[model samples]
Target: MGPLIPQEIISLDWNLVIAFVVGIGFGFVLEASGFSSSRKLAGIFYGYDTVVLKVFFTAAITAMLGLLYLSLFGWIDLNLVYVNPTYLWSAIIGGIIMGLGFIIGGFCPGTSVCAAAIGKIDAMVFIIGIIIGIFIFGEGFPIWKEFHEAGNLGSLKIQDIIGISGGLFTFLIIIFAMILFKTGEWAESQFTREEY
Candidate 1:
């Protein structure tokens, strides 16, 4: 009954339109939340400002709970939802590279774009670096193709892997997030930054 496009409730023609609208909405929210500021975004790593962690954690939990409820009520077909196939080696290497980039540049791809849109010079430079990185990766794809495709674990969810019900997994995640939130609050108090 859901996964609108997969169910044919929404036609393919509207996919890009929906995505564009959602992207704009997301960018607007990021800006409003002060995520456009590199300092604010980077504070998550420094343990000063936890708004980034709090906002993202809330979003994850909200989405998880929303999907759970929707599936429970038969409003959505959970099976129709897409799960990205896992590429183990590529994921690990990419995560490390991106983590370093985030720490150094103070912006992930999304936040960089959001800040760039608002005329941030640093974000603009970050976007240029991102483009250069992409160009290099594309041009050298043949060299890393084998490594990228080496660890092909098919789409797997935590609940399926751990032999638990989705609801139980969601509950666990909620508890974990609550603990993180408290930790983040404490960290902010301990690591208070005069500039931020």
Candidate 2:
């Protein structure tokens, strides 16, 4: 009954409009929460600030719980949700590259875009680099197509891989998030700094 777009309850044009509105809202929230500051975003790694971790974990857990409730109430069909197919090697390589980029640039692609929107020169440069990287990746895709497709794991859910029910997996994730949040609080206290 829900998943309005896929179910045709909402028209395609309306879906696009909704998506744009949501994106703007999300960006506003991110900027308002200081995600526009590379220093603030990087603080997660330095242990000086744990706001990033807290916000990320809170959002993730909230979404998971919301989806669970939605499914339970028959407002959405979990089975209708799309999951990306796993390309093991490419995923690992991409993740490593992304991690390095995060450490060095102090901003992920999303935050960089948000910062760029607000006139951050560094973020603008980062975005240019991202566009170039995308171009290179697209150009080289054909050359590495085999390796990219090597790990042909079809769309698989974490619960399936871990041999647990979705509900149980979500519960465990929530618990893990809570533990990490507590740890983050401790880290922030220990690493508190006079500036940033």
Candidate 3:
């Protein structure tokens, strides 16, 4: 009834087709959201623009609510979903490194692809940097293997850890996002500029 791939009700070809369609939708949305511009993307960090944060948090909350309700109605099997295994310290370390990359390069792996598609030179460089980072990770995988496999907290949901009602948690996250959205809107006004 859920996770068409894991359950094997759908063929691999169907999966690929779905993936392609989803990728196109994703790309279209990113471009329409102005994510193709590195300056627009970078503004989230500098307080000049915060479309990035607003879109990110809004998407997160939307998905969070959808999953919560889907599970509640037994429309989806939450356990069948992919859960990123926690690697303890590596999450913090990797997140910090990614944050630095985003701040400096102004793109993550996905958005960088869109930016490069739209003829952004800096995004092209960022894509190259990501490739290099992946190459480095592959070469050094042996060294990081221990940390990568460490603290194996298997497939967990937020409710599993916090012992709260899923609906309550989703509501709280939405409230938090509303606060951030307000702040982001304020910063956009306060930090508006008349010159490039």
Error of 2 at 148 (Å): 1.8
Q: TM-scores of all models? A: 0.98, 0.95, 0.92
Q: Which lDDT values do the candidates have, in the order given?
A: 0.94, 0.90, 0.87
| Tens digit of per-residue lDDT, candidate 1, span 1-196 | 8989999999989999999999999999999988989999889898999998889889999999999999999999999999999999999999999999998999999999999998999999999999999999999999999999999999989899999999999999999999999999999999999996
Worst 10 residues of 3 by lDDT: 151-160
RMSD of each: 0.8, 1.2, 1.7
Best candidate, lDDT-wise?
Answer: 1
User: Could you give candidate 3's per-residue lDDT for residues 36-67 as a string of tens digits?
Assistant: 88788888888989889999898999899888
Candidate 2 local lDDT, 1-196, one digit each (tens): 8777778888878977897999999999999999999999888888988899999889988988998899999999887777799988989988999989998998999999999999999999999999999999899999989988988798988899889987899999999999998998899899898886
Q: Which TM-score value belongs to model 2?
A: 0.95
Best by TM-score: 1
Question: How does residue 96 of candidate 3 score in lDDT?
Answer: 97
Off by over 4 Å in 3: none
- Candidate 2 Cα errors over 4 Å, as ranges: none
